[model samples]
Target chain A: MTARPVLSAPPAIERHTISILVDNEPGVLARVIGLFSGRGYNIESLTVAEVDRDATLSRITIVTTGTPMIIEQIKAQLGRLVPVHRVHDLTMEGPFVERETALVKVAGTGEKRVEALRLADVFKARVVDATITSFVFEITGQGEELDRFIGLMAELGLVGVSRTGVVAMSRGPGGI
Target chain B: MSAATSETSLTGADIVLKALRDQGVEVIFGYPGGAVLPIYDALFQQNDIRHILVRHEQAALHAAEGYARSTGKVGVVLVTSGPGATNAVTGLADALMDSIPIVCLSGQVATHLIGNDAFQECDTTGITRPCTKHNYLVKDVNNLARTLHEAFYVAKNGRPGPVVIDIPKDVQFAEGTYRSPADSMPKSYRPQVKPDLNRVEEAIDLLAKAKRPIFYVGGGVINAGPVASQLLTQFVRMTGYPCTTTLMGLGAFPASDRQWLGMLGMHGTYEANLAMHGCDVMVCIGARFDDRVTGKVSEFSPNSVKIHVDIDPSSINKNVRVDVPIVGDAAHVLEDMIRIWKARGKQPDKAALAQWWEQIEFWRARDCLRYEKTSKVIKPQFALERLRAAISGRDDVFITTEVGQHQMWAAQFLPFDRPNHWMTSGGLGTMGYGLPAAIGAQVAHPDALCIDVAGEASILMNIQEMATALQYRLPVKVFILNNQYMGMVRQWQELLHGGRYSESYSEALPDFVKLADAFGGVGLRATEVGQVDDVINEMISIRRPVIVDMCVDPKENCFPMIPGGRAHNEMLLGPDEKVENATPEDGMVLV
Candidate 1:
């Protein structure tokens, strides 16, 4: 039997952090999320918060991965939503800031516990809660940093983990 | 905004009527129920907006679509909660697909009983979120008028589409200050209606240098109103370029014009499809590259430097990538294109263009639409030809169709010379869209002859709309090409499923003549080829609603069919001699 030769390799998949400014009214979030799910666009991480009090506007940060064409479609589709005022692709629009927070709970003692604390210190993770057999660490940083800290904590008896999905902003003085 | 006196405050139901009146909505196609009793009561007190009560909620929405498409006005629909709302979903999706501007007001349960699983209650907004262009759940009475106005604004704006407002029953009963459309402008929604000058210039540059250029038009031209169609005709005339319309775009250009190449797509004419495939420059105005239009997307207009003009920015590059993408209303873009073309004073390569036209003429000589005519039985194409002969050259004649082989035949045989004269469920392919749609058109233009070119099986899907036509006194004609089976499905089965047939046959069919008479309308039947033209004339002459059942060859299949997943060049022009005798396996590859 011969292996079938690959007809074509797929296009490179790139992650895009898109920020959408929308009315903070009822079902606005659902509308944005529905656009993603309905169109079969991939959403990796999502965070939303009310950004303007007087304007009643909410900012939604989404981490999505797709080919360049699909990413363009995502932004265009998001911009087409009725309540949406603006959509910015942070990944493509020059330099930007992205942050994620994670809580790590490690249940261990002795050398293992000491090692976990030392690693937390190096990662600049604060020990939010400490028990005789466990330590709860509060960490806020880029997604990769949290991922590394969580991965290291796994060796030190990582019991539980909670994370707030990544939130993004453009580095320059620009508004989305 | 505070609590006011009764003189200033009006109930939400009254506000709904007042807001519709304010919006200059002439008519509303609706069906009332338990949740909408308050609105119905308010409707009883009103006289401005004429309400046409359709038998099914689905028919109401489709009827509204017909009204919208024919009149270039935002079609209004009203239906009660749950079943009523669910039924309208198909029509909503249809309007969304076709970009028909329709505002649908669906009644919901009492505000407090919303999530309690109360009677006749569904998550109307949630269910309709994906289908509608935009939707709202009006919870408060004060917001009712604004939402209604905003709904109209959203529906009729750039890339017009269906919008839904799910209003709770209590909100209808509650009193709130009524506000006009100007007071409650849309807070955040604004669509780009003007094309980028640079992009327009780029498109003009492409058109100017083109050797084999073709204008591929779609329904957006019609949705942009009559001026877009006029601009398209003018632009095409100015360039003297070959023009072809998609199924939805049929009447945007004069079908009788010398430069016209029938409708282009799977079942489109040979010359049109070939021209599309062979073109060096393709100027696509207000038409998305739909799958039906672009058979085997990878190979669609491969060599053409394509320019796409659409009001919706997202529609551009959604399916087929274009070299120049202009985001604007069809009218505005065409106007700018004309201005720029005139200012630049650049002409197409005449020598190359002459060769292109010669090639197009050579392809046209094949006459792919010519089918075998038999004296013994009426072919669907022959029937449509006779019907077309009766209605042709009349500006007031409008045609709607159910989705099937008959619809394609109507597109092939009937030449539309004006925009909005042709209305069919192009995007959603919703069956039974014809009958109610015809009624809606008749309601819009009472004196104009509106006809639904229907198939036997597809017409039965919403056959109840015949009653709606009679009740409204709308003299719409239903000319059914009565083939015994679901002809399209049967044809596909023959090609793809080894002629299994399955359940495509329609058994226990009703006596359409008796059914029509029972509803107090005229029904004419013609089984013989000789009687086709007579019945069509008689059906047209009648002032009341009529159904002409033209029995056609049951085994006949629609031709010029680029089978699914096939390239445009691989279309099967049906057998020239005898269509009924030719099986799918005869001289054809499966794929």
Candidate 2:
């Protein structure tokens, strides 16, 4: 029996963004989640939307991290499931753009409030909802930027956060 | 309208009954409640559909599941909303886990009162969402026809599961254009189920790489038919691995094959469980790793790489972890695995494979099934053997079983050379399933001999179906293993549970022969070992519903009990591997 090589992370493991095309209908999302859940595999972030004009199909982008072995399993299993037209492991194929939009709110006063706004501006976060005592910042970009914004706000009185989850795609790609 | 069938204006109930008739649905097991009363009223006018009113809503559903399993038809059940639908939950969930096809129709409390939680208004659609293959909360009365068509479509298609259609009371009573749809829709309703080449290759790689690989088989094999038996045997031979089957997957692997491990879980083979837990790689085919199979889920196959192949998506990770999960039909996937395996020019090492085979054979012999066969008035094995001899291969005969010692004996002793050979309540172990299921089976295959091998106490559950069977002229032969006690319970009392005898005695059975005559069918009692053949022949000669109240030595228990959680090789056969009990000529004795 050939031993499976367990590759070590080069200093740090990276999360690759993935996008998939699947038939849009009832139970489609459940099927996708089921594939992840059945194998004890984890899905870091997920989002699905009915993207086809005729209402017959949808596009789902998921963000997850693992060693190359796990990622291959994920792609292969996803491709084998019914109604899944294609599975594109964007991480392995080429460069890919990953984005997430989150609504972050912080309640504080004085220097803490000032610190929150300062951090939001640096991250290009928009203030969608605001009051004298609180500010709800809408941030759009990579997951790391959102994480940093949330972390700083947590110390400066982060109240609540609503994330639109992750939506990813291959950068200049043939459709998969 | 579906991409296949044309749209019709007939009311949903009209369309449903007509669709069922078109599919050759002979009988329906159901309960009538406020919401579903309208459908029942319409059913009254339809002579083609004979509906059996069960005492409990759950029984209606279970009886339908039994019916489907015994006869291989899409079992039909109808009930009212709220409690009526909820009561059927256990049965539906059982069918879901076992992959039995059942179409559940529950009456909704009218659309206007839906979310308001009106009187007896339950969101059956939501309640059965997870358990059903697909469920519909019918909103458009216009689309009711299509919805009913699709409900059957999903339930019977791909991996066979329960499907519930929540028809509002108004819609059931409403009038519309209804036309019978063809049985051909399930073909396209599901995606092409043929296996993908790469996934099969990966599975083959896992098979080839592992030193100890085990194939876990379940009811999915039954779904694949004769091809499953041959295909799986080929796969087993190719991979040179041992196999374990679920209670429902009994006949998928040939009993005569040494590599075949007996049914796993609760009453599963100890060797199979050990192999499952110890194997480096496990290929689970046509099975969901049920809680029973993986008792302490955390401790189940902890170090093994697992692959799951099933048609249902919910089954993928609902329980055990999967390394490679393939969603497709069993036969198709097996075929693909075979083709791709051959394409790779791979061959299993015969010497090494045969060595693996020897270990399984050792376990099999250690846990061999044997009864103390002597001059017994009725031995469970003798009954099984005689029944096996009597049934003609040219004729299609179906057997249904009630759970307990008798059920286990049937599962183990019956020689089913093929798949879908025996139907019993494997998951729930319900006692009263046999008779009703037999009636339903008779309804499905009108020409077949529908037999329910039941224990005396267990037979009483749904015993009222005897009248229903007679009313329909269904030739259901009920063989009652009259041990004069709750045999399994009594055995536990005798062996493990401190001999409590807690309501295990039979103070309730009437003169069964008189009872049978009373019910308008032939009845006979077997008090002598030599009488078994004649009694069975007379029952067959009667060519109608008959009851054989067999008086077996209640103490002659089904031996070789493998205690729960014990290793397979460890067994509690009769003392010193001997049967020293009193002979059957000793006659009936009161404990």
Candidate 3:
């Protein structure tokens, strides 16, 4: 008898940024989101916007984390949705760019406000609004970079924050 | 002015009927209400499309499913809004799981009153989105004809499933320009029907060289139409490989063939399950590796190099990772594989195949289907065997089954020789599916014998359908194996839960014989072994709808079970039978 192959270990859980192109119609986004929530798939972040007015096409970017098998299931399931035209896993498809924009509001005195501005400057954030006691800094960067900027501002008397989810694009001439 | 030119200036309700006629929808199963009165009036004005009024909206969908499965046509359903649409949810889910092609048209409140929590209003499209293949909410009369055609196209194409189209009352009253299906075909929802020849060639190579090979077929073959089943029979016969079918795929391959290895799964035959576990090359055609078929997924078919062919791209690699995955219609792929295999002219290893057959024969000799005989009371298996004998030579017989021990026993004992003859809710395991489905099948085949193999508990779930059968003069038989309990549930509790019989027992059961009489149908009863055959004959001879209540042994349990979390080889043949490959450390996992 031949030696039996050993059972492989469970696949690693890693985040994947998937982009989907779908018909821009009512209930299309709900169908995409319902699939993730119904199947118990973890959705870390999501962003959607109409991409083409003539074609009535919309692009949706979803950040999800799971094992390799689960990731395959997510993409396949998304592809089966009638309105969805294409699904591309940016993480697996070579180089890609992902960016998120966050508005950081800080309410503090002299030192904390000055420190917040310094860190925002390092993170390439722009002060969109300013008052005597607070400033709303709009920062656009990769999620990790924004996390670092938000972390520094949290200790500097950060009051509120609003962040857009990740939106991704493949780093090539091709488009979805 | 004429039928051909009547397309222009037609009400939305008239457009619905015209689209159904264009799609060749001969009959629809539905229950009408206030919101659907306009459509019902249009239905009354038409003679081409017949509507069967079921007692409940759920039965309408199931009946439609039966009609679809039996005739290879899209089943049409029409029901009202709110409670009518909600009631059809279970049937929609059932059709989705079984891949039955169904187009359910549900009436909704006026478009203006949709979100106002108006009387008899519900979000039918939103509620059915996850279950249906696709759904549409038609607010405009102009889009009604196109949406109706699209609903039919989506329901029956590729991997077939149920679709819902919610039409508001206002839209039904508005005049619209009706378009033909040819002009209104869906542009964006095209599914790939042709498979890559490279993958087909790869699969042929594996089949040619395999020492121990088996064909695992599923319901997709039947859904692909009878031509697919014919090609499957031809391909499997040409290769001379052993074959086993899933519960939903009972009639795709002739069960009487020498190569047949009965049904394979939890309560499958010992030879079939063991062959699946031990085969070196496993070719899965049109069947997903569902959890019930693959116990403890990681250890399932561990040694087999698998080839899976399914039409749905999403279905591939969902449960079990396969070596060769071909996405295409079953018939299309099978035709290609046969051609490629014939051109290559490669054969399996003869000596190794002989040894494999010898091993299979050894396992088959165990006769795991044998149960202890009892003349005092009717055993469910024995009753099924008698029923099979009674209908052995009948060529126009179709069987539908509810979910329970009776369904498993029917699968084990009943042998189907042709495609579309066996209809059962396999994936969803719905209890009330059989009777309504039988009504639907009877509607399709007016003179054919349609019988529903049901249990005492399950028969009660859709007992109201008996009135539907009587009203339609369907003459469908309801064969009830009256165990006086939810037999499967009670058995599971007895074996797995330390004999703690919960609410599984049917405490206040109706007298089925009298109930049949109450429904203005013939009622037959068989309480002992001697009367079983006589009762079956009498029931079959009756020209009216009949219910045969065969009192069976209450404690009889379906056997040859690979228990939850157990491997294929680790089967429990019967209650007293020894557990194969029993390990003390092997935990009992709850399903």
Candidate 4:
């Protein structure tokens, strides 16, 4: 029997990060996520905050994998929530900057320690904390940039890692 | 900012009333209490805004949900604070999950006493934050116009949902002004409906290339109406796509279409599902990938690449990973798809798709969604069949339902030949939904038949609606499948819940015949199978609010069920599966 193509499209696909402005209410996010989760859409990274101080509005930044066609659709639906005032596809709008903050800790006294600092310095990652046997590095950038930095750290005595999920915004004057 | 409008004096209650009146709100369901006495008193002055008083706060909210779901208008509800505000939670939660539009205004304790837990004080906005689509806490009377304006806008626009506003009792007594309607509501508040032409073009391009294409229309299409219907058929003809709907999406297309897959999911047709599973492309419209439709997520439609069209942006990649996400109202986006397809001068190979249509027909011929076996007592299908015969092809007729074995049976068997004739609480899965919804639908279209197909236990949740129906003199037909048990739950309990029935069976029931008779309407409680046709004929002859307590097979459980916590396609059907004939001869066995 011929196998149906699973993971058929790509060997390595570029992942894009997106953030949406939604109403800060109970079912708003669920309705948004339900739109995804109900349909089997996976959000690689999701973070929501009631950015409008009055708590009347929320911004949900979601990082997902797809072609540009899929990204446009996500923007359109996010604009449809009653509470949703606007939607911004940070990836599509040109020249937008992206960042993800990660707290990394590695414990070692041998050459692994020297290697960790060497890699951290090269990545421009900072040591927020250091002890007799361990060091904690603080790194912030696009998820991929952070991932690459963590990958090199992982082999060199990676111990624990804490990440604040994705938060996104548009590049220019108009805000969603 | 203008003195001409700003200086005008209007109490908070006056502002609330004016805002609602501006929205053309003709009816509101509510209850009175200490915190909201001023608003209710002001309501007495607004002759145009009619109020319906319900026995319970929950009833008011459900009625509002029903109104919103039926009329496609913002459902407005009012209740006092504390217990009153808390009571509306169920209805809010129900609307929230289902994406129905409802604006609930709750009275709060005086603002100064808010945190003290003073009498009738409640943080309605906070308590409802998780359940409502959006909620507001109005601290000043001056903000009343904008708050109510935003509440209505938020509730009715984009992924329609419930919105709540907490009004302090003192605010209602304070003075405010709402002279300009535009001032009350911001211009930026409208939901963007322009379809993504690029995504639409891409979808059409994919459709043109697809050899086996299927379009799954959902309730969102029905909600989008006239425009949605106009665009859907246009797309199907151009794309040579066979379109089907879920229970919620009934009227999105003509059931008579050879392209129609009559509802798809748990109780959905075998061939329709197989066709979806085997399709080269699936265009999912306004429908979330509900578990009932996609049985096992991993096993769902392996061969098909999905294209989800929904107005909510987050839904695009939420559930099933979509190849193409088209965000806009189902109707609006469909319009763009049709336009793009026509502009491209593309023609689908209809003949090439004939084989797939034949496959759907093959399934239709083998096992159409039917349960027809003429017998002794009234068969539920006969009741339905008779209802079908009685329909005069009126485009306005609506059939809403409560969730249960009977509900599945209705969705499976009902012949909704026209659009807008089928309605139900799909996403919320709220039972006891039929009676009030039927009444609400009847209220929306007084000249049309607004009928409800309900189960015995489910109807009891809002049986008082019979009074509402009779009060309105609505000719809404109520079909109560009185098997004296929670049939759907029991079927699962016996089949999967270890056969140790726990509260799944109900033996005590008030005589529904007398109940309807006392309510000043018709009630036909038939037991013998032969009575099915006769009682249905009699009930139709009256054409009024009536209840037909037909004795369905007590053991006549709905089949092709996907046990709870399982995927949609994984049904509990086997060759050994048997339900009682439930005929008088069997006396309806408990097992």
Candidate 5:
């Protein structure tokens, strides 16, 4: 028998979550987006909101994936934006917490309805709204947990889903 | 009235003019439109700042860039809304890529009409966000003075680039309190200029032990001003190291120096590229490792330990990674490197360096720039040679070039002894950049000989600038090597694309002499090789705008070319070249 040779797999593409503090000014967001689009870098998820009202500062959370070299370049390029004050790569730094909220709608009339409700209960999802034949469940958890819940609901007469993109923070008392 | 008096209430227009005066702005290249009328009215009321009206908004910005690159100050431009601001985008991108400091004042629709799509309305700030280093939108007249002052500060500071201030039409007419420079210092944008001493020590240590060291310089050294160039020259001389410069960095180091390897890149000298590829330690001073400079990154100087010195931190490791990265001004870091070398009592290994010099001399002895001289048709290289000879003794000549085969030939033949004397579009490679840049240089130094070395195809891109030169009575010379084709494109097509000529030939070229006459300027053409020198002399003696057309050989291609995507040592030499010792296997030295 001929021996089969084993080949090493290519480097895995790791996901990175980064947080940025920037001056809350007009076109600042456009500038950040431009950096990503102009350089052909991918942004998997993004969430931004003003953090400090007095200081007029905003925090932006971005989730992206790339090779190690590409991730470093993205961080470097992001830090160079004029309005940006600081950038923290949470994935590389240390432990971090991430949360996402998803709304799932299921339509059924009999056993499927009971099965949907049972699955929601197991997944710790709350019924936000209901109709005679449909139920809208609001589930909040880590991205993987949400994905698992959505996959289970798909088998139990799942009709639609609306998800808020990933919003992450460091898992400590320190604030960005 | 001195600007110190706070009791006077100034209109926004007056405030803008006053602030420009306080910033030491003597000239502004601009054009007037409906939305910018108020600013133009203010400009008309003052004799302090002279506004030169350009034929197109793009020319205004390029002229401003030329002025800034030559004068080492912030070039200012003013244009109206919509198409006017849109027209300046190319020049803004060019300035950003080349690191030329420019302050562009773009007029906008009234604050209420911003997103309403009013006549001549556009989102100026949104459009310019990517092109400008920084930008601002002034909705209220109360902030106009402060914003304009800050615009200049941001534009001229560390790693200088173009900054735009979009002011609404209402803001221009409204009343505002004018602020001085001392009052509106930036709060968050302080650039780090000092170098870390430990890193400087590390760099010096590497240089001390380096057997084969080469200094790769770039435009940042020129942008750092004359002192930086002086420090670089001192450091190179003290160490007795050979140096090569990028196309934009041509004049930063004296090209006449024997240790100078010619400009390095796709069309650079064979010695410079080989030295860059084979050096044991490479010290890149103020130049980014552009893809053109470092062809095929995996094979680029694989054995060298690289040290990069730049003012901008992001530029470091953006392309090719380096061992020691010093984020500081070129002058500051070079000063520290010199100091550290002196303190260590270190000197380069002379015997080992002699071996390196022997290799470099072997490459240089190939006569990479040599070309055949024909009596019938004037070669472009010969035309530049005659031009160089004509301006040999004069120290006040400034040369600018549009992009193409002529640009490479000019880079090879021209000798610049000082910084700011050679200006061309390097990063963006924008054609039609030379004419307006020459006009700007001429405007800055009225008595100096400003020549725009152009190709037949490239010059036609901004041929309208001839009127601007004539109106200002600026004695700028447009020297065209009329080769009747986009020679660089044609050469590439011939080499890489199996000689499918397709759209590269410039059909129906204008009668350049008649065109010059129509613009009310002197026009001269040399059809034969013998008449080239006389035509250049007559064009120079006219003391007005003149275009000298030297009909050059159309078949000539720029030689010593490292074909795109090839290693530096994989160069294609020209015809009739006899480097008897070089073998095909030796050409793949780094591969």
Candidate 6:
């Protein structure tokens, strides 16, 4: 049997970092997540915390990747969520800043231990905890920078890693 | 009515009842259970809001939707916790998709026992959040009345949709202040209703210069109330342009009007779809460009300068980009359009539109709805036509339908002369929507003839609602076109799935005559075409709940179908019909 011809779709996947302002109420976060999951939209990373305690508002930072059309649909669908007050695509709206924190644990000795310590210092990672066999370093930076640090630590006996997903804000005076 | 005194005096249940009364809620569709006993007790004490106890929670919600759609008001529903709330999910999603405003009051397990897996306890607010416009859980007694009022406000205003208020059992018994609508206005939520005049002017400019134009309307006009429908009619009449309505927009403009092209998209008329494809200028009012309507968006109305008038900002440019986007209520924006057009002293190009009408007439002459009549079996289209002919001259008739081939047949054959006369599950295409909706309409308009044009498969979805009609003594006539299959699915299977029937057949269907009798209602059946008219007449003459099962030709399929994923111009005509204007096929492009 001959193979059927495959219709290739455009392989241009772009990552979008979006910030949403919403009511800090029970199930509000679930609702936002449900909108993505129900429609089968992919969310790469998501972080939410209460922002204005007095005003009862929360800010959710979501990193997702899709085609241009899918991204537009995601934003439109998110805006239709009742608790969501504002949705900003930081990636589309000019220059923006994003950062993530990771805790890296390295188990090593001798030259590997010395090299790990030297690399941590170079990456501005603080030693939060230490044991005889392992040291846990707290690193905070952009996703790619943290990825680089983790990559180096992997060769020097990386044991475990934990990360807080990307949090983003538009690079301007105005807030979403 | 003093705030201080009432704040210290009223229990939560009493507060809810009083607030509902103040909001002028005349009826509520509900099912009582363990968690909602306290609210039921409050309901027992009051006679202002009549409660119709539905057999199932889903039917309660569907009935409320029917009530809302037929009357153009916020429908109210009340149900107990857990399964009761879970059962209402389908109806809630249906109402949300159709932009029907319904306020569902659901009982919950007491506050302290909420996440402890208490009996009849479920995460109602969590479950319904994605389905509702807004939802609230009243944790404290003090917030109950305000939250309830706010739910109503959020539900009925701006792109109307269902809202849920999950009231914990303890909160229902605890004392709280009774708040009125005038007292508790939502601080954070106020929808912008008026359109910017600049956008209105832009739309008018586009409309005036058009050589070929078609007005497309949807259910949003019906939700905007009678004034909007009146304005839509006025504007369409003034322009003298051809108009086509989505299934939801059926009655917004009188179907009898000469300018009317029948419901467009999917199973829409050949003329309507052709007009949509060929128009140079398309004015879309109160209608979202749903996938069913637009077909393949890239090829939808390819040469048109589109103007979309909608109440929801999110709806505009969501599916298709438009030249002019006016975000406002249908009535308000139409008023502005009329005003701007008059100010410019511009008339539609009559000579140019005459040529467009000539093209539309050629498509119309094809009679896409036509089918060969037979003496042996009742065709679904002929049944609806006979039903329509029997109900002719009756202006107070309301039509509701379960989804599928029968629904499309009803849209094609029936003539709705006024707004709010047609109610069906348009967006969600919920199957068992018709029976309960008809009961709801009958409850609203007791003297009006309310009919549920249902299919055998779809009617069985919410068949238990027949009990609600009997209990309420509602004069609802159920006209079931018994084709013995999920006809639409069967049609797709025949055309697209190599004739694999799958599980689309309605096996062991109930005998409607016996079933109606068992439910304490009248039942009629007609197997032959000769018996169709007499049975419909008998069904109409009944002053009580009636079911008329008209057995239709099982092999017949809904035609003039824009087979899913195909463009509007590429329609599949019925059997024995010649294809008109066949485009050159790429062979690789298969829909």
* Stretches of candidate 2 exceeding 4 Å from the true structure: A1-112, A129-134, A141-151, A154-176, B1-8, B17-28, B37-59, B173-192, B196-218, B226-246, B251-328, B333-367, B374-395, B482-541, B551-562, B570-591
Q: Is candidate 2 or candidate 4 better by lDDT?
A: 4
Q: Which candidate is the best by lDDT?
A: 3
Ranking by DockQ: 1, 3, 5, 6, 4, 2
Candidate 5, superposed: residue stretches over 4 Å from native: A1-12, B1-9, B576-591
Q: Candidate 3, residues B360-398: lDDT per residue as tens digits?
A: 999999898989799779998999998899999887999
What ordering of candidates by lDDT runs from best to worst? 3, 1, 6, 5, 4, 2
How good is the docking of model 1, by CAPRI class?
medium
Which predicted model would earn the best DockQ? 1
Give the local distance difference test score of model 4: 0.76
Q: What is the overall TM-score of model 1 with all chains considered together?
A: 0.97
Per TM-score, the best of the predicted structures is 3
Q: What lDDT does candidate 2 reach at residue B440?
A: 69
DockQ of 3: 0.66
Docking class of 5: acceptable
- Candidates in order: C-alpha RMSD to true structure: 3.0, 8.0, 2.7, 7.3, 3.9, 2.9
**DockQ of structure 5:** 0.48
lDDT of 6 by residue, B96-210 (tens): 9999999999999999999999998899988888788889999998888888888888899989999999999999999866766777777556667899999888888888888
Per-residue lDDT over B374-481 for candidate 1, one digit per residue giving the tens place of the 0 to 100 score: 997999999998887887778999999999899999999998999999999998999999998998899999999999999999999999998888887989898999
Give the Cα error of residue A132 in candidate 1, in Å: 2.1
lDDT of 5 at B121: 90
Candidate 5, residues B1-591, lDDT tens digits: the string is 465664467877788888899899999999899889999999998799998888888889889988998899999999999999999999999999999999999999888889999999988888888888899999878888888888888898878999999988899989878778877776567677898889999999999899999999999999999999999999998998999999988988888887899999888999999999999899998899987688766678888999999888878888888999998899999999999999999899999899999999999998999999789799999999989999987889989999999999999998887899998998888999999999999999999999999998999989999999999999889999998999998887676556689999999999999999999898999999889889988988999899888899988999888766567877778844433322233233422
C-alpha lDDT (0 to 100) for residue B390 of candidate 2 = 79
Whichever of 1 and 4 has more DockQ, that candidate is 1
Docking class of 6: acceptable
True contacts kept of 1: 0.72
| Evaluation by lDDT, superior candidate among 1 and 2 | 1
- Residue B465 C-alpha lDDT in model 6: 88
- Residue A55 in model 1: shift from native, Å? 1.0
Docking class of 2: incorrect
